[model samples]
Target: MDRRVLFATLILLAGGATGVGVALFAFVGVDDATTETTVVWESEPAAGDDGSGAAVATVDGDPLLLRPAVENGSRVVRATVAGGDETTWTVPISGPDAERGGGDANGSDGDPSGVSGLTTGTLGGDPVAALTTAPGELVVVDAADGTERFAVDIGGPGGLRPAIGDLTGDGTPEVAAVGTDGSVRVVDGEGDSVTEASLSGDIDRRPLVVEPDAEAGERGGIAVMTTTGDPATVHLLDETGEARWTTTPNVNPYSWNAADSRDGSVLVLGGTSGNIEAVETGDGSDRYEVGLQDLPVEVGDADPGTVYVGGSGSVWAVDLLDGEVVWKQQYGASTRINEPGVGDTDGDGELAPVVVNRAGEVLAMTQRGKVTARGGPDAVVYGGPLFADVTGDGGDEVIVVADDGTAIAADT
Candidate 1:
C-alpha cells in the first residue's frame, strides 16, 4: 500500500486520535524498521529569544538562522549556523537609554516594547535585516556582522511586521512597513523613502510585497489589509505607493497575511470569518472563496495549485482555483496550530508542510495531508517553524524556537 494511504488507514483505525503520539505512530508505524527523526543540533536559550518568528539568510555562502530577541532592555538579533557559529547585534532603538516607555533599563521584565520580528532584506546589495526598533524608527543592519547600515524614522508606530521586496524595479530589495496611522511606507535598500501611501483604516499585519511578472506586463505591488473594519479592505498599491485597486473580500479584518499565488496572479488570505479568499492581483476581484468549520489563524505555504492553512486545531490543503478543499486534518480540540513551513523535508523530491502547535508538537505532513514525521523540543512554542539547509547537507531541516528560547534543528 502507498505510505499516505496506509497512514490514513492507521489514523482512522486509531479513532482519529490527535497529538504527537498519533503522529509518531503514523510516521514510524508499528514496525521497528520505520524511520525516526534525528536531532541535528540544539542551541542553548537564545538570549531573550522572543519566540515570534525567525528568518534565514545566506551569509558568506553559509545559511544563517536569524532569531529575534530582547537583551538587556535592547532589541537584538542573533544569527547562528548549524555548526554553532553565532553572532549578536544590538539594535539601537530611539529612546532614553535604549528602553521603551520608561521601562527598566535591564529589560529584566522581558518587555519587547519597541521591537518587532526580524525580517531579512538587503542594504547596498549586502544582505541585511530590517528591524523595527520603535514605532517610528526602522534600522537596517548587516546580516553577517553587527554593523549598522542605515536607520530611518517611518513617522508612525509600525504596528505589524514589515516585508521586503524589489519595489523600485531597481533590482535592490525594498522594505514595506505598515504604520498604526493607516499608512504604508516603502524604503529602498539605501534607507531612503521610495514612496508612501495612506489607507482608510489601520493594518494588523505587515504589507505583502508582491513580485512583478515580466511576461504578463504586470508590475508587482504591495497588498495591504485593514484590520479596523468589517469585510476587510484589500488594497493593491503600485511601486509608487499609488492604489492600483482596492476591494473588500468577505474576510475579517484581522485575517492572516495574504499570500501570492504560485504565478503571482492572485493573493490568497484566510480570515476569522471562516472564509479562504483568493483575489485577482490586478483588479482586486474575487477569484474564489471557500468556507471552513473554524476560523483560520495562519496561511501557510502556497504551492502551484494548492495552499495550506491552519485554523483552530485543524490544517487544510485547499485548491486555489475553485476554493475546493483537497484535504483536512483535525489536531483535536486543544491544539492551536501555527504557520507551517513547506519543503522537501524527507529528501523525497516532494514537498511537505511541517507545523508546530502551541504545545510544541512538530508534525510534518505529506502533500496529501498524511502525517509523515513528528518531532518537538518538548516545550511550549509560540512562533512558527522555519525550514532551511542549515547543515549544508543538501536537505532542509526543521528549525523551531521553543517558548523558553531554545532553538532546535531536526532531520526527518
Candidate 2:
C-alpha cells in the first residue's frame, strides 16, 4: 500500500523497550521471515462529552492550531478556539517550580518571572508545533512562538533553536536543541545556559534527532545526528555535553528517530541496517535489534518498558528488559499511520502509542489524524490523548482538532 509508513515523515514513538515474540502487523508472522500482514484500525470520532467538538485552531485551513507550547512561567500556551473564535490561551501548567524561568524566550534575559509577546516560527523547515520543559530553566518554548519565557540567547552569538528532552531522568526535562550554527547546547532546567558543543564547521548540517537516556542516573545523556559527506553520524551525549558514543549508517539512514526504554536503553531508526537498533543509553553500545522489511514507519514504548513498532499496516510490541515480542496486530492494509506519537488515551493509568490513520473509522483530511484511548482493542474511547494532564489535574483530558478548526476537550 502506498500508505505504508514513510521515514521522510519523522515517525517516532517515545517510550519503552522489549524484544520480539508477538507480531505487530497481523499478517507478519513472528517466525516466518517472509511473513507480511496488512494491519488496519477502526476509526472513531474524536472523544469529548457531546461530540460537538473539543478545542481547535488553524493557520489557514489547517483544522488544528500548532502543537501546544509550554511557556516557562506561564502554564501551557496552546492555540485555542471557542464560539467560532481563535486565539492562544495560557492554561496553567500547575506543578512545583512551574515558573522557574521567565524572560524574553529569545534569551534577551528580559524578565525572570514571566514571558510576553509569544509568537511562532519554523525549525529546519519543520513547523515549530509546540514546546514544553522539566523543572528548572532551560526553557523550551516553541521557537515558532517568539515570546520570551526565560529568554537566554543560545547558539553562540546568533542565538539558536533547541529540542528538549528529559536527559537526566530527574523527572525534569532539559533543553537538547541543536543550534542554527551547527552546535549542540545543553542548558539547565532554569533557562541558564550550560555547555555548547561545536557540531562541525558545516553550517548547513542539522542534528537529525536528540533524545535523552531512560536510565535513572543517565538522565542527562543525549543522542544526536550529523552528516559527513553523504554518510550520517549518530552520537550519544552525556549530561556534560560530551560525545559518549557515535555510530555511522550501515546502509542509508532515511530519517533519524530515537526513543528510550525505562532502563536508559535507546532505540534508533533510519540506519543502513534497515532494522531498528537498540543501544545502551550510558555508553551507546550495541544491544538487541529488530528488522522491519519495510522501513519502520513509527516506533513507541507503551508502559516505559516495551517498544512498539508500526509499519506495513500493522503494530509489533517488543519487550525492553529482554527484547521479547509481546503482541502484534494488523489493523488495516490501505490505512497507513504517521507521526506515531504516544500518550495515555483512556486515562487507564497507563500511556499507549497513539497514531493518525485514514483507513477504518478515524478520519482526518490526512491519515495523519490522531488516536486517543488505550488497551489492545477494548480501550475506552477518549478525546485526543496527547500527554498527561501536563495541565495539573490528577489525570489528563483529551484534546483534539475538530474538522471545523476548533480545539475540543473531554474528561476521560
Candidate 3:
C-alpha cells in the first residue's frame, strides 16, 4: 500500500481503528499501543440514477470520505453516501488531557471526555486523522475508529491545522504544519520531529502539496504561501522542509488554490485577482497566466487536461496547455459560490463541476457550466463541498456542516 490514497488507482481499506459490523477499521489510544481495523464494503459501479457511475471520483473501488462534525463538545466523523437511501456512520474523537493528551477514540468503552474531532488524512496507507488533542499538541487518530496512533507537540496558539502527505516517497506520509511563528514543522509517524523549515514572515494560508511534475509521485514538495512579505512569497519546499523554489505570486491575494498544470509539469495557482498563473516547478520561473473573474476561490482538475476554477458566481473550465477559458458559466449576483468538488453529477462519462457557497447552496453543473441538479442551503458552507461514497451504496454525496454544528449529506 502507498502512503497516499490511490485516488489514481484503487481505494485500499487495509488499516484503521478496531471495530466490528458492516466492515470497519479502527484503532486504540496511543497509550494503549493497540493497532487494528475492520472494514466491510462491496465495490460496485459509482452511484447515479442509472447506476452508470458515481458523482464523485473513485479509485478502483469506492472509499468513504470523512467529515469532522462537532456537536456540543463532542466531535465525530460523519461518513455518508448519497443516492437512493443514504447511509451514515460516526466515530468519536478524544479531547483535552491534564498531564499529557491521551484517550481511546472509542470513548469510555465508546465515549470520550472531549468535544473536538480529527482532521482526515492518510496514515500508513489507511484513513487517519490529525487531531488537536490539546492547545499545543497534535495527535494522529485512525479514521476507522478514532484511536490515537501517536501524539506530537506542535507549538501553536493560533490553532492552525497541519497537512499530511508522503513527503519522502517512502510509502509513509509525514504531518506538516505551519506554526504561528511562520515556520513549517514536519513530524514522522512515531510522534518525532523530522524538520522545521522557516522561510516566510507571516504565514496566513494553509500549506498545499504539489509535485511540480505529477509523475514525481510522493517525491513532490509542499507549497506554503505567506500573507506578509516584501513581495508576498510562496515557498515550494522539498521533502526535508527545505525551500526548493520561491515565487512572488501576488500582493493582495484574497484566496488561492493550487492544482497541476494540464501536462502535469508545472503548478497552476488560481487567485481571487482573476488571474491563473502556471509556475515552473524546477526554478519557480513564469510559465503562463489566464485571467478569469468573480474571484476564482477554488481550483482543481477532475480530468487530466482540464482545470476547473469556481467562485461565488462563476465557474470556468480552462485548457491546460494554452491557458484558455474553454468553457464558463455565471450564476447570479445573489448567488455566493466558493470552491468546487468534482463528480459525474448527471451520469456523464466525464466529471462535472460541483460547488457550494457560504449560504449552503449546492449545485451540480454540467461540463458546459449549466445546472444539472440543484440541492440545499443544507449547511452554512464556507468552503467547497466534500464528495464521497460512505454507504457502500455506490453513488456520491455532498457533505456539509452548518455554522450551528448541523452536519448534513445532500445528494449530488
Q: Candidate 3: where is the Cα deviation over 4 Å?
A: 1-119, 131-134, 212-219, 294-296, 300-302, 344-350, 368-370, 390-393
For model 3 the local lDDT of residue 251 reads 23
Distance (Å) between predicted and true CA of 50, model 2?
A: 27
lDDT of 3 by residue, 1-412 (tens): 2232111222212122122001111111111121211122222221101110012223235544444444344644444433223334555545533221122111101122222233466666666666443355566666555466786655552234456776666667788766545667778776688777776476655566653333654247777777556546778898777888788864235444455554455656665555666666667776666556534345655455666766557666666666656555554344556556676533435677776666666666666554555557534444455555544455555555444333445665
lDDT of 2 by residue, 1-412 (tens): 2343222322222222254122232222212221221112122232111111122223333323333233454444454422224444444433333232322222122212221222233322322332323232223343333244454444532212245555655555555555334466665555666666776533222232334434354444555655553565667766677787776644344433455565665645533323555666566566665555444344433456666555545555556655555544444464443334455444556555544332212211111122223222222221222332423445443343332212334333
The lDDT, on a scale of 0 to 1, for candidate 1 is 0.66
Q: Taking the tens digit of each residue's C-alpha lDDT, what string does model 1 give over 345-407?
A: 866677788877777677777777767666566767766777777677777888877765677
* Better candidate number, 2 or 3, judged by TM-score: 3
How large is the C-alpha RMSD of every model relative to the true structure? 6.7, 13.4, 16.0
TM-score, one value per model: 0.83, 0.54, 0.69
lDDT of 3: 0.51
> Which pairs clash in the backbone of model 1?
none
> Which is the leading candidate under TM-score?
1
Ranked candidates, highest lDDT first: 1, 3, 2
